[model samples]
Target: MSTPKPATEATIRANRAVRDALPFDDTTDIENADRGLIVRATGQILTDEGDVAWDFDRWSFLDGEAPDTVNPSLWRQSQLVSKAGIYQVADGIYQARGFDLSVQSYIRGEKGWIVVDPSISVEPTKRGYDLVCEHVEDLPVTAVIHTHSHIDHYGGVRALVTDEAVASGDVRIIAPVDFLEESVSENVMLGNAMARRKAYMYGEIVGYGPDRAVGAGLGQVTSAGTVTLIPPTDIISETGTELTVDGVRIVFQHTPGAEAPAELCFYLPDHKALCGAEIVTHTMHNLYTLRGAKIRDSLIWSKHLHEMLQLFGDAEVLFSSHHWPTWGNAELRDLIASQRDTYRYLHDETVRLANKGLTPVEIGEQVNLPDALAQKFSSRGYYGSTNHNVKSTYVYYLGWFDANPANLHPLEPTDSAPRYVEYMGGADAVLERARDDFEKGNYRWVAEVLNHVIFADPENTAARELQADTFEQLGYQAENGTWRNFYLTGAMELRDGIRKQHVLVTASADSVRAMSVSMFLDYIAMRLKAPEAVGLSAKFAVVLPDIDERYVLELGNGVLNHHPGTADDVEATLTFDRSVLDGVVLGTTDIAEAVERGDVSVEGDAHTVRSFVQLLEKFEFWFDIVTP
Candidate 1:
């Protein structure tokens, strides 16, 4: 048997040539108005894990357009994620960037640190803390302020402080009212599906390399670490709430519906410093995140930013969780105004195009960032592209329709995939043409063609490999971290196929221990198999031993409703502590085993509740995609 030829330099060079021929950035423009001063340029620091490479100069490209800047918003967002490590924005306030996605914290009372947002992960968060500790005297964390409910903004909480601090009342956790509920509901209820989509949306599936990763544009990538939920000791329930932590006075401005559902900004009267959280970041934030969520209100977002401008017009230092800090009143004001107006433009033009009877696609095409707004680095869409944001803005105001009756009923993906492939010609013919285009470095065309092939028959290795190669080239050429991750992740999926891994399958002892009785019932409600419950009627009363709260759950017509108080009649009454329920959710034990082990007690008709468990579906922890 003859062995296949090894991958030669010629083959490597051939791949290299394709990557080289593709359009990519060829210039560096770091000459921001506040360069080397307010936004210090310390170049780049390698991640401690050494899993990824960082390039600062290449990221701050603004002098050129087109491929050099994948999207203006993306470029500006990358600036925040990849900016310098540390700088003194005010006398007592400091920001540590590049330590991980714009981690900014406030130094208070000589020995205590009041952290605003810790980076994206524990490692980088610790790295940032070390950097801060090196410059100033290391301080114990007296308080933590979570500005919003995004993973990157608060994922590093464990690194900054511990629950011991909270228990001892040495440290206080503060967040906007409803922040905890919103965060828990969003992350936990849909964690499995959201995690899968996030693997694509954030490019976590792809390896970090020149052709595989730049970052997710928000940050390099979220680090895998402990996720702890410490309840807020104090919630910012109202706008303009005044509070002081460790001798640092803060005036809070609640900006709901601007970014996260419950988000706020705070200004320090003494230092004249401001923390925008994710609300008014350096780049255009998502009107709709790719992973999935309710569409954000851009109109409300813009109005809130405008309010911030008036509220903190005299703020000397402005910092945020996802980007570098801006110092000086004039520069800070300009940054705020530019971001505020950009959202306004996106919202107004989208509505304007919609009023003209333009479809979503047409509306997106008709809208463009005004030159002035486009030129400003802060207004660019490093994380959120203009095209997507335009469509998102329309979607926010108008529902998912163009008022075109033709689109009223559309073919689903499975029905359309094979038809598209057949119309374009058979697999062999399409593959030959795509391979030729790949050789010609027309990756965009190659990708477009292979998409049909894969959708039609995802198991075709030849088609998958060809498409993977094309996506790799695009990933390599992409300047935006999010774009790079998108392309690279697509390539990885094409090559290795999708993996059905659930990160939340194994719950942390802390997250489980911290789980509340109400929260447990909510989790079970989310697990209800809607289809199975359809046309079925059942009622069960559940009792928590410690809390002494009686709850009734009604399942009928594919809906599960929970009542805090007792119901008139329940078919079965089940009694168990919260820990036993956590074990069930974590898949550590069967319902019967818990009952057998005396961990749970059944009262009344136990068989009815047991029968309900049969209706519940257990999702697979892993699935074989490539073989399938």
Candidate 2:
């Protein structure tokens, strides 16, 4: 196994210039982060059993000067996000920061506290609220505002409010329209694969350190705790939707198709504050998240920000779910304008270049944020890189194909690796030249060539080690935290095998039950083994009595098709509550137990459903990456 190395001379010089170019004199963010700190946490948050779930103490290392192993700009951002505490944002507004990847805000209402975008997990969010009670006022949660459908924004719903409370109207859950569908589908259908990629994205394999996971650019990292969800009671459908919850007149600006598929920002007219949610954060957010998702519309993103100015330009304070708040109307407008311009530049220039026959990769390579926009700290590539954002913009309009016939039919990495290696004078010859380039700080070229050698021969020790070293250098130089994590985690996997033995990110039990019967059936369709179904046909009626819905499942031509209501000549009619099915699928109740316990009943020959189950394949989450 190889060890992580220090920054090379070339990397050090480049990083030094970055430090010089950025505005170090500006301390507005630093002041805002510490402005309302009640008690700066210097300890750990514990679970029910007194076991540590989140340790604020360990990240105290961020107080030190930037190391050679980290981008100074990222280090600065990390330090700002590392300040964990309960802070007063205004006379009635409070924020609990650094408990998780997202901030949880509390707006003092006439009756009780209205929580906004609770953190990622139960323990942390519960702890954050408890702290608020101890330091501030102890009040019941009147409402929960899920500003978006992202997991980090609303996964902690059950921590603050329950389904019973929501049902009784004692606790009102607010979210954008399509929040439930987006939240459930995003976490369930592609859960395992996205979760695996998210491990690298969040630097889970690589622990936090000066040289390792400094920050997420927006925040430090996610809470490794129990995730929960409760459906929203009040859905904001259109822009200009106003809700006067406990005396705070909140005006909503629906920003769907911008950041999350369902996202919105709100303004407190009385407080003169605007909660930007995840749409407008301290850094440029991912246009296309590496964990896998549909490409976000940058054009729409810019439009929303422009709309924010028109609607909430007079907002005295601008608070977001991730980073610290910006005070003063002037600074708030300026920040919004800069963020707006930065994304607009990415959208416009990428399209302009694509029209001139530049491919996505070509455009990404040449495109740079103008100095006017790049100088602003918020517009910097701390989370989302300008390069990747540019590429994503091109793909957003045109799509994955670059229009070149050769590119359109390019060979898969495995299929072409051996030939590429053979053409490049074999493995040893390539490694010999790669070593020279690595010494000369040509890490990117070395990485590209070495990947072919690695794919051609996984057991080649020299090639793997060189690739690991190459990735480490790239990680050290990356300003984007996600990029750093991907590079370093890839390096770690090359040196040591994948860390798949750990807990995987999956949809919660509540999420599973909350999913519409149609969506759950869609997930079932994804699990169908196409090859097993080929030339074999099966039909079944999935009857969910709880939802008063029946869906017909059909398997033919290696594809599983499904729809609402009944179908003619179905082989089996499987009747079960959505709850019982959730328990069975989540492995809490086995199929035998469910049948014996009378949780699920079947008619019209159970053999059809049994054979259909056999045709479905269980996904193995621990598949290879950075290897064949």
Candidate 2 runs further than 4 Å off: 48-52, 501-504, 546-548, 584-600
lDDT of 1 at 477: 52
lDDT of 2 at 584: 45
Please give, for residues 1-628, the per-residue lDDT of candidate 1 as tens digits. Answer: 1111122233355444434543334222244323434334444434444533233453444333323213333433443455555666667777666655446575665458888876555655666677677776577788889898766566667878877889888998888988766766666566666666666666665544333444566565555544455677889978789998888788999988877898888998898888888877656777887767778888899898899988879998788776566777898898888888898898888998888888788877778788788765556566676777889888887789877888989886557777888987889889998988877768778887787788788778899888777776665555445666777676676666574442322133444555666776777767778887786687888888776878888988877788787876888777887778767666676676676666778777766666666666565534433223
Q: Relative to the unseen true structure, what is the C-alpha lDDT of residue 442 in candidate 1, on a scale of 0 to 100?
A: 80
lDDT of 2 by residue, 1-628 (tens): 3457778887887678889999988988899989988866557777666656677877878877789888888889989988899999998999999898899999999988999998877888998999998899999999999999998888877889887898999999999999999998888888878888888887877777877778778788777777788989899998899999977899999999988999999999999999999888899988988878889989899999999999999999999999999999999999899899888999999999999999998999998988988888899888888999999889889989988898878888888999999999999999999999999999999999999998999999999998998898888888898889999889989988876644437577877877877776777777778887786787888888887989898878878888898987888788888787686446565554565566778788676566666676666677777999
Where is the poorest 10-residue window by lDDT in model 2?
584-593
TM-score of every model versus the real structure = 0.83, 0.96
